[model samples]
Target: MRVLLRAVKQIYRQPLCNAASRKRSIASSSEGSGLLQPRHEKLIFCSTAELFQELGGNVEVRTEFISEEEESAFMKELEQGLRKKRYEFDHWDDAIHGYRETERDRWGAMCTGVLERLRTVAFPKGSTLLGPVHVLDLDKAGYIKPHIDSVKFCGSTIAGLSLLSDSIMRLVKEDDAAQWLDLLLPRRSLYILRDQARYEFTHEILRDEDSVFDGERVPRQRRISVICRNLPS
Candidate 1:
């Protein structure tokens, strides 16, 4: 049981004090040869506040999206429900491993509040939301291969609340992989992908060994993302 709480406990302990200290001005992907030029300078930490502007307003993040109590509660519910589950492989994409997922028609009041807030900020007033929320649990060693969500399943805007661990998500142009940007997704942050970000780019969680940010190594740990999508147009 204690092991289950190990990752969630990081929420109350480690503050993101280093976020500003490691901040850097990244030129637009078009300015330089690539967003991550030189390969050695692959990790760049952009401020979440300016991520919308930095990433052409297609991608946005809201840090501190959930309170500590809410996170703790979510951890408890998920750990118990998913502990006995085994990792499943997708026949379409082999890059994903060590992961389990489930869909929920509805969540508790506590989650409802979070979802409300997400829609309030990430979507326009009275936007239609998909009823089934997707919960994906990825092990510390797990990694998601770069792929775009099929338009048949969901709509344009995709909102995800990241929990448990800090991670780096890379969004690369599907046609040109060299043109890419890295997003530092700290625990409890809400990331919203819409329009170009959702359609033109393939999103993937980097492997543990590749989790670097601004010349520093950022460790990847167990993470669970509560994902919500808008109705298909």
Candidate 2:
């Protein structure tokens, strides 16, 4: 019982609403329905960057991590490298549409150099880079559904370099759907997710019409993300 109470207190520290203290994972009634009651999923869009930091610095972003010149060169290589690969709309679980993904253990000289720089900010000294690096292309109308990175595929840290266009990435707490955050990923920005932010949050790319930040509609277009992960734990 003491252990359970401690767990409840920890959740309480993370704000929900005015009645946050009264919130319980499973609603109960005097009549004792016994069956778990359904709780409405209330998406609270966190417009500020501070909320992300509240997660013990598990999520971070470095804007303009790469310059325009580097971005252009990387984009050119990505397009050229995957020119022949087919973009598949029908994912096995329908998680992504109008997307093409490929992995490469090695990149061209320019890309290799830029990624080396990315490592300094994204990982600790001597952290192993899981290969081949993942390159995903999303069409102008494409979007990725909410899902967690499989522990089987990668370890805790996953860093993505955004290119081509800007978009919103939403992260929802797996245990509490009402708790969520929307991140504006501009072109040339690098976003990193690790530990709790990487495992506990289900990340998704918002559809174009649904992309909004701080009450302003943020337009999304054909975008690509160069994803790098560490070896599985």
Candidate 3:
């Protein structure tokens, strides 16, 4: 009778332990979910034409960009494949060459989508999609110097897709000495530059092994950027 009484007491105590464990598990899961979410505040989504209109309205500050979960996944896959293939740096070779040499055959698809969208917004009368995409690989301390991408040099909008890692692109107006805009281009994000934003402002990637902002220095990772612009005929 004493043994049976002890067993009953133990069984009654088990529920309290299990409830406490469950509460702790729930708290841990919630914390993890919050961290996975993107923390950037200015991330916005807009249709291509809407973005063009906004750009025209605000010449001093104009940027058309978007981030999609599906696109990001595709880009990650592409990055992994490129890493496996060990793509070389060829300054003379165009974007198509890099795409062909890479393991994943995705560069064409990505460029096509951006070109079609840009044409719809920038050239309503229809225009040919010219190519030889520029595939640029930037290492820990590599960066592109600031300069305007004039239509005289390249006749279409500049569409850049981030394949691996994240970086910042700075836009500075020629006239504004103190004003400049910084954009964090995360992995798989797409940035389209055109009009005055392309012709008047200078865009560049800073050379740093890491980036520090708000007192946090984020380490640099290997980055591959696919740049698409129409060739002037």
Q: Please provide, for model 2 over 1-233, each residue's C-alpha lDDT reduced to its tens digit, 9 standing for 90 to 100.
A: 00000011111123332343223221122131122113211113342334443664576655667778888888777777677877889877667878888777767788889898777778767777786788889888889877777777677788899898877887777777656666667677778888888887778887788877546677889889998888765
Residue 43 local lDDT, model 2: 19
TM-score to native of every candidate shown? 0.75, 0.77, 0.53
Give the lDDT ranking, best first.
2, 1, 3
lDDT by residue for model 3 over 176-199, one digit each (tens)?
423344455556655666656665
Clash pairs, model 1 backbone: 43-214
RMSD in angstroms between candidate 3 and the native structure over all alpha carbons:
21.4
Can you write out model 1's per-residue Cα lDDT over 30-117, one digit (the tens) per residue? 1112222243232334324243244566776555667677888777767777888887665234646678877776567887787777
Q: List the residue pairs that clash in candidate 2.
A: none
- Residue 191: error of model 1 in Å? 0.8
Each model's lDDT comes to 0.66, 0.67, 0.45
Please report the candidate that would top TM-score against the real structure: 2
**Better candidate by lDDT, 1 or 2:** 2
